[model samples]
Target chain A: MKRVLAVTAFTFRELIRSRLLFVWLISVIVLCGLDFLLSILSFGSTLQIFMDLGLAGMEISGLLVLLLGLAVTYTTEMDQKAIFLHLAKPLTRGEYLLGRILGFFLVNCLVVLGMGLVIVGLVVFLGGGTVPVLFYECVVFILLEMFVLTTLGLTYQMIATSMVGVVLYTFFTVFLGQCIGEVQWLLNQQLSHWVKVLLRVVYYILPNLEAFNLKDRLYDPNLVLGWAQWQDILLYAFSYSFVVFLIGWINLEKREFR
Target chain B: MERTAVVTDSPCAIQIRGLSKTYKTGFWFTPKVTHALKTVQLDVYENQAFGLMGLNGAGKTTLIKLVLGLLRPTAGSVAVLGGNISQRGVRQRIGYLPELPYFSKQHTGRELLGYFGSLHGLAGSALQHRVDEILDLVRMRSAAGLKVSGYSKGMLQRIGIGQALIGKPRLLICDEPMSGLDPVGYKEMRDIFIDLKKAGTTLFLNTHILDEVERVCDRVGILHEGVLKEVVPISKILESSVPVDYWIDVDGAEAAKLSGMPFQETVRNNGGVQVSGLVLAETLALLTARKAQVKGVRPLSSQVEAYFLKAIGAQAHLNRPIGGRRP
Candidate 1:
């Protein structure tokens, strides 16, 4: 446990010093600015459009931080061999993976939450609208989604030899995970039996990112986020994260640091 | 060409038997396996400064990584500190300084040590004191406050040693510890090795520096092409290599007589003379028998590099039957 905390703290500090947080701040500003401008240019309800884009802005910045975080750390840990100082010690491979995952999650949480607050403040003071309670719910779901992606990203870092390969694997996984819902709709179509089987397998295999896509349904009056729904979503996130974390741990143990 | 065992029954700090590593690359279906380390056997005992010498691509680093539990051995076992390398507590007791150590530039030397100390379950005052102690041991007390980016190559090496020493480990594995240091820096490192030895820390050093091995090591293990060629004591290697040449400063009157002797080179220097020869005792005895007053007798430097080269140089010593001779 102590080893995990130490790695967690050190990895967090490494991310901060790598200027990843600076990148996050810059992303928040640029993304929110782009959303604000696009909402005003559109003909629909500007306020609702802005809120929708703000949530989109949050997800974009959040995902961006995690993806970039994995790349930056992969370079430092593998290419630069900073991992020597850590893994050479008594810390177990599992603890090291867990700690790094936690570190990545914390940094991602900061990016999403920091942007959420800024957008909320902009809506209340300048956009002439009160921040809805549902917006916070969307933020919570976005946090959970970020958790899953971060774990998945780190899992790839364990298996991929090159930094570029790790990044590519993670980006493709995020794309497939985001497309699972649309593919589910296709699963119901009049496709061949084998195609449906393959689609069904892909749907079940990939994380159901749509389950945590609360931001897309924020304006839907029929949408509900009661205790039961929260339990299911959180349960799915934790179980999936646990499996990914285990895969990364086993790979790390098997890896030979040349 | 004979290799001698350390010849001690004491409990070993590190024990390896038939260790090998094969790295797999390429696509899953068509895999390429590179044999990084072949079957190698070595043993190092407590408080002994053992140096592992090898050239590039010679599996020196691979062996060290195996001991540190960073790489899994394909067909062997490694035990450190009377336990398996996989044992968690063994790592806490073993410090490592890797070749060309690179750390995060944002941390100061002190901060880096403190951070590593924390990983070893150190905290607060105990960690602080240990950090300070290692800093002083490596002579980095003044530079401890400076960021790692501001450090010179030598200072970086020192801090790398400092981090390794921070845990107060019983065994230290230093890989290529003297690869990039100047003369002064090497001297500093050499002194630290001696100090650590005196403090009862067993050291497992991997390097290509034969001079360093001669100076600081108790025993030396030469590895070539992923094979263990020989294990011999440093003191015996030095004792075995006959001095190539010896110089003697003699009196003026004895110069001409010394010049007439066979297998001796005599140079007239002012009123006196200096005689040189390949064998030290023969020349000294001849001079004394000839009634030449000997002013000084000094043996030349060591020939460790020669022995190391002869041991690992295309002799196929690794393929020779494993036999033991006393050093």
Candidate 2:
């Protein structure tokens, strides 16, 4: 446990010194500032405009922060061979992988909270209203969403060497996960019973990112999240993360550092 | 009688029998097999600095990696510190500094030491104490707070040694520690090796710097073409090839004549002469027998490179079986 904390702290220090945190900060500021301007110029339904712009900004910036965090965390250490120093000691592959994953989780959580605050502040300033509880609920779901995204990104980074390859693979999985609802609707229109079964299997296998989207109903106080629903989403996100983390950990254990 | 047989014990810090690592590179065309190490046997013991001397691509690093359990042995067993290399807990007492130690550039030297120290299971105040002690030992106390990117090559090597020595390991393995060091840094490293020896650490040093080995090592195993050519003691090698230098105060003509003697060279200076020969004792004896007044008998030392070349050359000539006695 001490070893885990030491490795994690050092990893966090490295991420900060790599200028990634600054990038996250600057991106959050710029994207939220632009969202504020869009809310101000909005003609019809100021609340609707603020909700649309704020949620869009939150989603885009949140995904960027997670992907950037994953890319910086994994690729930089690999290129520098800085992991060699830690692994050469008495550290097990599992400990090292857990340390890095936890470190990235902490960094991305901070990014989510920071971006959430900025979007909330912009919503209050432009729409002249207090932040709603549903916004807070969306924030929690986005944090959970980030956990799944970062783990999948880490899985891709483990197998792929090039940064572009990792980004493309992660983007593909995320896009597929996002479009599964639409694809399911389309498949329901003209499918035999067997085809429906196959599409249903695919839908269950892939992530249902649409469940995390709450922008349209965020202002409706009646749309509050209950305990059981939040628990199920959290469980699914954690299970997916665990499977990807296991794959990465096993590969890392068998890897020979030449 | 069936239960009375005796078993011989292995006498090495690491022992390997018929060790081979065949890496497959591709799925077709025989898989591009590379026999990195093959059928090698060696022994290293306590209080001895053992050198694995070889040129590049001679499997020196491969052998070290296998012994450290960084690379799995494909065909044989390796026992290090009396424990199987494949076992989990034996590495606690071993310290290794690889050919290239990759440190986080953003980590200060102190933080790096603390990080590695904790990995070795040292905690809190104890880890911090060890970090400070090792930094002082490696002469990096002032630079402890400096980032590694600002350190020079020599400073980096010193810090590498510091990290490897944090546990005060019983078996310390250094791979190419002296490469890319300046002369001052090389001498400083040699001094550190001697200090570590005095502290009772058995060193397994792999280097192409033969001179450093000759100066500091007690025993050396030369690996040539992936084969152990010799495991000669330093005392025997030094005694066999001790060089001699003498100054003959005789006239310059006699000095010139003395220079022409087989295998002798003369350096002239006004009325005196300085002569160097392959062996000083034989030359001194011959001069005394000839009634040539020897002003002084001084000894000269040969560098390890010259000594290594001569030794390898002589071994090549002595390869044949003995034909007859010198009757």
lDDT of 2 at B187: 83
lDDT (CA) for every model shown? 0.83, 0.71
Residues B1-327 of candidate 1 have per-residue lDDT tens digits of 122345577679999999998888899999999888889888898877899998889899999988888888889999899897777789889999999899988778998999899988899999999998888878889999988879998898888888888888999999999867889889989888887888889999999877788888889998988989999888788887433334566776666757666555434542232232245577678778888888875433336765776677733432232123101
Candidate 1: global Cα-lDDT?
Answer: 0.83
> Which model scores highest in DockQ?
1
Candidate 1 Cα deviation (angstroms), residue B246: 8.1
In model 1, which runs have C-alpha deviations exceeding 4 angstroms?
B1-7, B24-34, B242-301, B314-327
State the lDDT of candidate 2 residue by residue for B11-105, as single tens digits: 56666666777667877865787887777777777656788887788788888878876677778778888887544466777788877676767
lDDT of 2: 0.71
Model 2 clashing residue pairs (backbone): none
Q: Write down the worst ten-residue block by lDDT for model 1 chain B.
A: B318-327
* Maximum-TM-score candidate: 1
